[model samples]
Target: MICYFSGTGNSMWVAQTVSERFRDNRLTDMADAVVSSNNLNFSLTEDERLGFVFPVHSWGIPWIVRKFINRMTIDNYSNQLIYCILTCGDDSGLTNKMLLKLFRRKGWQCRHIYSVQMPNTYVVFPGFDADPAELEQKKTAEAVPTLEKIMAAIVSDSPIDCYLQKGQQFLKSRIIYPLFCRFAMSSKPFRTTDKCIGCGVCVKNCPTHNIRLENGRPVWANNCTQCLSCLHRCPQTAIEYGKESIGKGRYYYGKRKDSQQ
Candidate 1:
């Protein structure tokens, strides 16, 4: 089984590639899974493997991903091989190690954890912008060959270095995440404008279902995943996180679903 959480389709692509290499595969979106409370009805037998793919945030796993892993209940699956793939824009740093600890607490043994560089979608940085055409080209060029190699490695049961093991330990300790939660996550979310077309694309696409239509505009509730799916997909270009995401290009994966019909 492969369970993945993707913010902007980068991690989704990685999850899809990994699943394609295996038989009897099951792919579940972390967003939908969370909405359904992860009631995925699959039994992990001895010969099976469990894989998780997601993006890295704040030099660690996203808060929702961590919650999902902690809340999951798996029993009688000691023989299953576990692997994780983290997609990041830059250095993953300590994220992989934090994941290992979480998995360990859940009684799962991890065989390998790996990281891949995707386009930096976290727009919080100052003056963040990328050429869409070039970004897409680079992403495709890098992903295709890298994913092929990763799939080959998984098939061959190759070994991987616990790259961020120590760093993860330090980050996950008492001080770091708590301070982050209090300060960083507590900041106000982006606001939507009257130009919103009442399309409900943001509502439907929000992984945590945190946005709801009120008076024909999207209102973000506190349970946001901060994935930017809603902000990126707004056709009117009306969504703004902090002071209007000036000069940041929006991205959407696959074909845009025609909501007008």
Candidate 2:
């Protein structure tokens, strides 16, 4: 099984791509499961292959993904070569190391971790934009060979270790992750502008079910994981997080060719 959690489709693209190669492999979405059940305990057999793919948040795993893994109860894990794939715009900053630590704490032995560089989605704040054309061209050009290598490694069940820069890893996983947990997950600043058209796309798409419509606009509950799904998927670009996000560009994973948007 290859499970994923994606806010802006970067991780989903990775999960879907891998699923296509492994036709019998199951493709599960952590977000969809969380929306259906708060406590994410699964009963998959140990003999089956298991994979997790998700975006790195604030130099660590997304809070919801961490929570999901923390609460899960698998039947048996010894026979499984559990693997992880982290999607990011640039570097993961030791997200791999921190996740392994968390898995250890949960008594799950993860054997491999891979990083996939995808388009950045942290645009809810000011002074950020989608990767410019040339930069995006460069990233995609690089991702092809990288994804191929990852596919081969997974297919061969190779236990590939990662490049662990201890200093940077310590800083990001220890220092940055906690700070982000303290300061970055707040949902108080989320609100929809007047352009909101009573459409419930944000409410429907929120993986945490933290958004709902009130008086024809989306209102955020405090349980938000800062996934930015509501902000990016709003058809009108109607959602804003405080004043800084008012005029920033809204980017979906493939907004360029989606005429439906």
Instruction: TM-score each candidate.
Output: 0.84, 0.89
Candidate 2, superposed: residue stretches over 4 Å from native: 125-127, 161-167
Write down the TM-score for model 1. Answer: 0.84
Strongest candidate by lDDT:
2
The ten-residue window of minimal lDDT in model 2 covers: 159-168
Q: What is the C-alpha lDDT of each candidate?
A: 0.71, 0.78
Candidate 2, clashing residue pairs? none
Expressed as tens digits, the lDDT of each residue in 22-51 for candidate 2 is 674677677667657765666666567678
The superposed Cα distance between candidate 2 and the true structure at residue 179, in angstroms, equals: 1.4
lDDT of 2 at 52: 89
What is the lDDT for 81 in model 1? 76
Please, what's the RMSD in Å of model 2? 2.5
